[model samples]
Target: MLNIQNTKLFWASCLALLVTSLSFGIRAGIMNQLGIDFQLSTSQLGTITAAAFWGFPLAIVVGGFVVDMIGMKRLLVMAFIFHLAGIVLTIFAQGYWSLFLSTLLIGIANGTVEAACNPLVAALYPENKTTRLNHFHLWFPGGIVIGTLLVTLFVQLGLGWKVQVAMMIIPTLIYGYLFSKLDFPVTERVSSGYSSSDMYKAVLSPLFIFMFICMFGTAITELFTGQWIGLLLKNVTDNAILLLTLTTGIMVIGRGFAEPVVHRLAPQGVLLLSAIFAAAGLYMLSTFTGNSIFFAAIIFGIGVCYFWPTMIGFVAENVPKSGALGLNLMGGAGMFAVSIYTMFMGNFYDNLIVKHLPAGASLSVYLKAPENSASAQALANAKNLAGPEILQATLIIPIILIVAFGGLVIYLRSRKKSRSVAL
Candidate 1:
């Protein structure tokens, strides 16, 4: 029984998530720096980005099974340790291989945060699970807002990017201190006598299976697009930080207002509308730029804003039998999309650049790009064409989601009507 008002615990969890979101913000800001420092191609940076996702599924899938037994505190402790170590490692990273390993560790820490906190919040406010999840997730974009501002601040101060990354350590330490002694309720899964085998059966059920599939598209649409925003806008804008901040600011407000939205649209209705927004937004982004860019971003941000939380909320409400494992599986499936697509998109962007190069131009010559000259202009041209092409390719994901979510809404509405008629 969560009889006590553990407001501290809730805030501690949010702080931890803020660290995760801040890490994402910092990374988005520094991606171009990393590319220049390492002299990496778009695809190679994709591999580095992909590294951050490698451990996500590993931790999340397993964390679901163990979170009940080991407790959220211990998992959070693990996250803190990895978070600290990963930051230190990232600060010291020199090349692709080093960055890859460090990001992989940080990815594990990020996954651990989700694995621990999702169930913690769900357990904390069982009466308002979905609403609280939406509220809790507000920090993801909020942290981005903070991070974007911080990035802008740090750049204005003429500080190195390392200082920006090191700044995350302050919150990381604060959250660790906050969670050091707070008591946690064992998940509903354990309290209700649900077994691991039962969890397996629940998650494997047809309804959950459909959700697992939807998670891939939804995660790809939101995260893949969000993470790559700076890179995708390389040619369109000299500074994308404002655009990134504005888009996420819209998301934070959207999530903040989720309670009313949920009452009005229900989760499925919101998702259906969100899919339409994401599809249209990405499609427009693929083809538009300059004056039209901000409008497209608003459309897409609104589409993706509700996706992660609503999907988590849907499963928690509708698939109670699967318990924390259900949330874990869904979360893991989403990360899995990042792991695969980051690499694929990287390679896709790289090939686009290569294919766009002048006829009879040696690929090796561009690979060893000349710092300043016609060679530089030619390379810029390749990237300009490649960036938008990559966005165009991602449209297929939301297009598929539209049909899937559309079917689910119809089926759920029918189910609701049947129950009402019976009553």
Candidate 2:
């Protein structure tokens, strides 16, 4: 189905995916570094990490609305600009607000990229949209692995975080050049003369609502881990950076094999399985108490591996020409939901940890002073009495979403069956 050797378009699709993947790594790794250097609390850190997702909802909404009108090339070019500007601002950012704004720009740019490219990939590979989309997403984890390795080395060698963020400019420019040269195909759905009113009507359809639910859960699954795993490790272990990379390593490996895996099970089956794995992993990680804690991350990575891109692929294959609007809404809604989830985690941590430090207590004292810190450390301390409670909340949210989305999938299948019966 790939036939990369025979088609530059195939290669271009891969390259575009690579560009976005590389872009995410630059932002995430550097954000982790910033959290440490700035002495930010988990809540403050969450805000920064979540900033990239803050603009996502709107970006998807607006990007989808304009994608067909503006064309893929223009939106992609705009995405490149937003990402580039975000990275540049991040390098120079001295305060939390600067970092937040910069990350927000990156979020917006990423939404634009998804809005443009998700549909483009489907249009280009109509018959194998799911597999190709899954394959295209391989670059995301691949880039994370590369970025993690490079950032680790750079940090160890005493290079500043600025250097790591500055490195993002390379892919942004290269991809911009390639996108400038590539020709994008128009999809059949958009090519038909469906009026603007009809296109808008599709956005309000039951199918679109079902897909949104999928996108939302999938977003929480992927971002909840990607954005928090590093912090989760630091809260539990000394080798946080290594642990972060290890989980992402598993994610890369999973995505590498996801094309064939998705092929065998198909998108819906893969999604159901992924949700189960993800729910179990989240519960386990949230309650982890031993050195075996690292295993939970691996499991979580495996569970979330096919989620984000597969959600995009599902939209592409099922909705096809929902056009740029469909792509933007999916990406935007996903990111926005994640940003909200991260913030929720942050607020809980802040109220429970940062706000109520006892008299004459330092952070270290509050963290380690057994009796005094016990309440504050409930979420952080794997052995704390309240840890399980917190973990249960995170696990339950996803479990519920999974059940809801699973029902939607079943309904769709039944509807199709009935249609066939009537025929």
- Per-candidate TM vs. native? 0.96, 0.86
Model 2 CA deviation exceeding 4 Å by range: 1-13, 355-391
* Cα lDDT computed for each candidate against the true fold: 0.87, 0.71
lDDT of 1 at 410: 98
Question: How many clashes does each candidate structure show, in the order listed?
Answer: 0, 1
Candidate 2 Cα lDDT to native: 0.71
Residue-level lDDT for 185 in candidate 1? 84
- TM-score of predicted structure 1: 0.96
Pairs clashing within candidate 1: none
Per-residue accuracy of model 1 over 386-418 as CA lDDT, tens digit each: 888888989999999999999999999999999
Which 10 successive residues of model 1 have the least lDDT summed? Answer: 1-10
**Best candidate (score: lDDT):** 1
What is the C-alpha lDDT profile of model 2 across 1-423, one tens digit per residue? 335422666565566566566556655666656755665666788888787787767676787777777777888888889988988898889888888898888878877777777777776777777776776777777777777677778878999888987877887888788778766666445775656776667767888878786777788777766655555556566665565577778877887677679888777778888888889888777778567778887887788888887877777667654655766688888888888888888768555544445444455434334443565464355323333444566777668767876886698789889999999
Off by over 4 Å in 1: 1-5, 362-364, 367-371
Cα displacement (angstroms), candidate 1, residue 360, comes to 3.8
